[model samples]
Target: MPISDFRKKKLLYVFNVFFDVNQSGTIEKKDFELAIEKICTLRGWTPNNPKYAETHETMIKIWDGLRQRADANKDGQVSVDEWCSMWDDYAQNPDRALEWQSRYMNFMFDLEDASNDGSIDVDEFTTVCSCYGLQATECKTAFNKMSKGKEVVSRDEFQELWKQFFSSEDASTPGNFIFGKTNF
Candidate 1:
């Protein structure tokens, strides 16, 4: 499914964090140098901590994959043009994209899954949405619908719902609850 520019821009900005690490408005190899520490913090891990070795490794893999795809020229860096074009990074490989999408969702889950129970409750969901600067209450209805009375969202639920949120034209798809505002 084709993604809207608005959403693409939003997601792009998220990706931009890695490339624009120095906030210079462009992606360079140096930007990735700080990724390990940042990714550790994002995953609630401490750098040089062995307990998080696995998670940290996965994060590195993800970053490596992004760099490989975005740095198309193999010139050791990805400029804004190359970074924005990252939308097509996996366009030719839906299965691979799906796998990456699962990891993306896992990262989101890790961010919001404070309980570490492998699911997101209303409070947890609200907290994650709040981080995006959206009003927490605004997503209650959508969360309710997505949770379907389950009161929590599992990994499978989040991944599938997120995919829909990324591509589904259906207004009722649970993906809309992701940010609490799907008007875009």
Candidate 2:
């Protein structure tokens, strides 16, 4: 689905608030690197782990995706102006964003779907949710809610939840629990 103008504007604000980890007035490489590190630490995904290489690679790919899509000046960072401009451009020409966003979501789903079973179970959900510093019990409950007793989440369902997570205003939405606080 294409991002609507309101959603695009909202997302621009959300990105700046959430991703400017350094609070340096810009989204820089250091900020991204720090975020990746914090995620790995929170998840206890370390270099010594068997899945470390794959996890590290995915993080790198995510950073690259951000830079490739928005680092307008090629300065390895995204200023507020650059970030807003990028989203404004995307809002006018949303087709391009759809492709990139779809690819990113697919890549994330594939990475977390370790069994390649076309769906994600509790374990898979835990793996993805770990980065958010969520407790196992909390994640399990959230997964149950999102799964609605199916005990597995299909790709389409996950995509819908992803969108909901980003755009929904309702505080109690199931997708809101998939990661950290959505209200912020």
Candidate 3:
């Protein structure tokens, strides 16, 4: 059977993530964050500040949205089977492709807000790092040194720092597209 457009795009998104992390054979927080950033750029949306993105309230909102689709039975939580089913359904809905895309983008931001709090904390930072198979210690160290008065990293500060972290020498060259190279 032919795949639906929605499913095709969803699969593409997953494939992109898998391809990026295939070298490590695990999806880490960095991988997830990169994927989210890429998706946001494609959609012309600005990603949340990394320092404050993983708040409990934000996470809760994100989890609630995902649960709404993943938990068809109105359960408060999603089992592995339910999650898989939602993923499968998303991959196959050509008719609602745009809606699915929107949901996926929203979910990424929500996931970053790991704590379900309105604000992100150090623990949330660690959780995000854990997802990317990276140590949060470095982030913690940097954050501690920089944050003198504020408990949370402001959006502007985080964005400026995140840019420095992700920037590469070749990043300035636009449209230097290479075919068949899947890793972004």
Candidate 4:
């Protein structure tokens, strides 16, 4: 099945706002490296830390998976067109993409769960988002929407949202804010 317009918009938002970490208009190794650096810095992780090593390894794996699956031209980068094309195929059965997507979802959630309590509070969410170049105010607002007034969002709840973010077509779903609001 083809990707819906709404899903396309969401995907574009992710590609433009999140994946293109260096504002280079494409997804590349450097972008992933920059993201890993930012996340490591936010977590106060260094080369000597286990967490840093694990995070770095996971991100590189993700980058490898993405390049393998999405770099249609094998040019060492994923262009926006290729990104949409890959996601269009995945939209047919989101579950097929779960192997890689779940890795990313868990990585993100763990990164935000700085308290290591298996839940993400607004402050933790905001800090991580800010490291990604998002405004703290926007991150806070997005957190409210995502958490649905809960003091903290548990891992299960976040997992559901993560699934929704990848599969749901409804605009009202809180998962729409998973990476914060997209400017349409």
List CA RMSD, all candidates. Answer: 4.2, 5.1, 14.1, 1.8
TM-score of 4: 0.90
Q: Sort by lDDT, best first: what order?
A: 4, 2, 1, 3
Off by over 4 Å in 3: 1-19, 24-110, 116-118, 145-149, 167-184
Give the alpha-carbon lDDT of every model: 0.62, 0.65, 0.41, 0.84
Q: Candidate 4 residues 91-131, lDDT tens each? A: 57766664667788888888888999999999999988776
Q: Answer with 2 or 4, whichever has the higher TM-score.
A: 4
lDDT of 4 at 23: 90
User: Which stretches of candidate 1 lie above 4 Å from their native place?
Assistant: 1-3, 16-22, 27-45, 48-52, 77-84, 88-100, 129-150, 169-172, 179-183
Cand. 1 Cα-lDDT: 0.62
Candidate 2 or 1, higher TM-score: 1
Task: For model 3, give the RMSD to the true fold.
Answer: 14.1
Best by TM-score: 4
lDDT comparing candidate 4 with the true structure = 0.84
Where is model 4 poorest over a 10-residue stretch in terms of lDDT? 175-184
Residue-level lDDT of model 1, residues 1-184, one tens digit each, is: 4555755654555555424666777666455556555555655677567736766566656666666667788876666667546655443443456444566567777766879998888888776565444677765665787777688888878877666555544666666566555344
Give candidate 2 misplaced runs (Cα > 4 Å): 1-27, 30-61, 72-75, 79-96, 180-184
Instruction: Give the true-structure RMSD of model 2.
Output: 5.1
The alpha-carbon lDDT assigned to residue 178 of candidate 3 equals: 11
